[model samples]
Target: METTEADGSLREAAGKVQQAAGDLLGDAGVQVSGKARELRAKAQQLYADLASVARESTLERPLTALAIAAGAGFILGLLRAASRQNRD
Candidate 1:
């Protein structure tokens, strides 16, 4: 009877330990998920900041730069056309 009692007590202790381990793992998973979300949000904010700066800063003003590029391309095309004709 004493041996059986000892075995039962051991089994109960093991069950309690398993439950505690499961709880700890669940809490750790929640913490990791929360941290991942926080990092992702921060990354998104950084991307937005960079994009806004690129779009609005004088060095990268989109429409003016685009017009300059188009004008240069058109001039190059005109030069190419003049250079390609046969003189004879």
Candidate 2:
């Protein structure tokens, strides 16, 4: 997790530099790629952090986590059904 955090931050910072350079050179492709890289790094960091938090929370309160998961699943099912009806 520590390594992931450090790597993600570094990748994101590198992407910023790349994006700025691309802007100076007027290269749209480079800018777009750099932005994508930055977003990927940000997502990875978010996932890692969220996974840690969820693990700890589940360990501390298993029943609460289970209930939340069930509720989320139910809501998703309802949303999917509504979307299908709209399509029909």
Measured with C-alpha atoms, the lDDT of residue 58 in candidate 2 is 100
lDDT of 2 by residue, 1-88 (tens): 5788888899999889888889999999989988988998999899889888998999999999999999999999999999999999
Residue range with the least summed lDDT across 10 consecutive positions in model 2: 1-10
Q: What residue pairs clash in candidate 2, if any at all?
A: none
Model 1 regions lying over 4 Å from their true place: 1-26, 58-88
Error of 2 at 53 (Å): 0.8
Model 1 C-alpha lDDT per residue in residues 1-88, reported as the tens digit of each score = 2443445445545545555565678776555555554455455556666666665664767778688789999999988888886442
**Residue 4 in model 1: shift from native, Å?**
65
Q: What is the TM-score of each candidate against the true structure?
A: 0.39, 0.67
Clash statistics: count for each candidate: 0, 0
Candidate 2, after superposition: displacement of residue 24 in Å? 1.5
